[model samples]
Target: MNYNKLVKQKRVIIERCFGQMKCRFHILQYVCRIKLENVPKIIIACIVLHNVAKSLGDPDFELVEQDPDEDEGNHENDELPLRQLGQQINKKKLEYYNK
Candidate 1:
């Protein structure tokens, strides 16, 4: 049934979209603490900004490439782990990455 191509077409593209979103706005990279009703508004705003940036040809703010073998859930996201947080940052950098 050509399942490999099917998976690539569906999952890969979707993940890439999400990865791009995270790389761009960064706020989507983690869980949100906002009210449920406000979540959609914030997402919509980010989408609009994303489209505008794409249209304007903004420089890509890349942090890392999407590794196919990378574990999406590798980090202990229920709480922040030490390494992913920049080693050189001060106490002022304690805010969430997506914040």
Candidate 2:
């Protein structure tokens, strides 16, 4: 089994899960402005709420659609550099895997 392939697939699944979670629970999108010491508690509360809502099969409370034309140019402009970097990183990982 290819470890790199397994890792990449796992990363994609994790991202999709987080995306669904955020879309379903818009309240979790914002950071709580509590004291530093209470930050962990705030995070735990948000996670508990998210899980309860998910278990209840609730629809997304907030879903915003992006304008198709707004970032049309930005996508092409940014993608090339990112693709190159990703390729480089993957190549290095492949080398490590082969070693």
Candidate 3:
């Protein structure tokens, strides 16, 4: 198979997987309140749940794709300012408390 065609096929499979993941585990779409350190574990768990649901023949999957130009509002903020490390630490602390 052509490399480009293989890549496109993989992308489609990944999109379908994510669609099944989100519908089978609604929590995947929510803003996670857990610490950043735990995010990977949560995501892995969701993937496992998605695969199990798929294997068991659960349906109701929908794919979501973001528009390419939807990030214009954050263009200026893309590069964090040098001084924001302290600000990020403070924000994380606040999020910790809020959760």
Candidate 4:
């Protein structure tokens, strides 16, 4: 048995399930807020609901393939300009020098 193939197969299945779950239930996208005792039940209920919705041909589960790395790309480029920061620092330096 090829380990890499097995891993890839499992990855596809798990990723698809997660994608569908998130697409259908926004609640699953974050941590649970339900009572501690009800957490298990709530999770099962959500999974059941997702499955039923899929079986009923719900279009909400339609997911696009997203590159997880794409989100982290160009994060530095998204940051605020350094010019304002430099100007502020220069003003502070001048104020200190004048003291």
State the lDDT of candidate 3 residue by residue for 1-99, as single tens digits.
Answer: 999999999999888777677776777888978899998898899887566544544444676677997855755664576347547645655665587
Candidate 4: where is the Cα deviation over 4 Å?
Answer: 60-99
Return the lDDT, model 3, position 3. Answer: 100
Model 4, poorest ten-residue lDDT window?
Answer: 53-62
Regarding TM-score, does 1 or 2 come out ahead? 1
TM-score of 4: 0.53
What are the Cα lDDT values of the candidates? 0.66, 0.66, 0.71, 0.73
Stretch of 10 with least lDDT, candidate 2 = 54-63
Clashes of each: 0, 0, 0, 0
Candidate 3 lDDT at 86 equals 48
- Cα lDDT tens digits for candidate 1, 7-70: 8789976777667777887678888888889988988988787665555454445557599998
For candidate 4, the lDDT comes to: 0.73
User: For model 4, how big is the CA root-mean-square deviation?
Assistant: 19.0
Which of the two, 2 or 3, has more lDDT? 3
Candidate 2 colliding pairs: none
Residue-level error in angstroms, candidate 1, position 61: 3.7
